[model samples]
Target: MKSRKGVRAAVTLAAAALGALAFDGTASAAPLPPGGGSWDHVWKGSSGDFTIYVKEYGDVVSICDTKADGKTPTVWVGPGNGHTTQYWFTAPGGKGACNTKSSSDGAKYRLKRGQKYTVTGCAWGCNTWDFRDRH
Candidate 1:
């Protein structure tokens, strides 16, 4: 009986640890800038080198390179409906080259409202975040 209880306790502890790790791996939206306009959602890269902002009622998505680490910041956006195609957006990166680029900047693509999209940011590595269009 004592051995069984010990095994049960160990299993419970392992499960709890895994739950915590899973929660940590999930990314949450970042706070918007002061007077930066209404944004449906925003996310900062895991490496703190870039930011992704969804705005204009989810009709536009913007990628900004926030750091001057000599590495370009890129974002991949795709439909959340299990679609396989993804569009890439990137910002100019270099020392003193913090800039923002958007999907609508060059008429690349337009996002639809009320649609879910998967966004991934790449700098040192790649991290993914999800955004849903909101009016």
Candidate 2:
């Protein structure tokens, strides 16, 4: 049987050790899986037409565009992940317009490390009237 004094001493040492290792405290949004397998693959469109693969918390690994008419837009301009891209598009009924180009596509594009990429544009501006899938 261990004495009470011995148990108290052991717990005090453990607390000191834990305090040393927990400095500069930071937390994660999701628990990392075993062997570092906490990859998050989310489909974040309203219609579920695109897939964004994020690994290691916020690293975007790959983006898969499933829709035939859907164009995978890049956050950067000038010869991006696709051949066709628009700087900005007007909303339906031409009420508002947003400009995203940097004077003929020379803007520096850098992905943020701990932030989410959001493409805010007119939701109904790029809709096609007729979409026929032949698969």
Q: Estimate each model's TM-score.
A: 0.58, 0.27
Name the runs in model 1 displaced over 4 angstroms: 1-35, 56-58, 81-83, 95-108
lDDT of 2 by residue, 14-124 (tens): 000000011112331221112323333222234433322233222222233333343442221112222333233221111111112222233232233332232221121
Worst 10 residues of 1 by lDDT: 11-20
Full-model lDDT for every candidate: 0.49, 0.23
- Which portions of model 2 show Cα errors greater than 4 Å? 1-38, 75-135
Using alpha carbons, what is the TM-score of model 2? 0.27
| Per-prediction backbone clash count | 0, 0
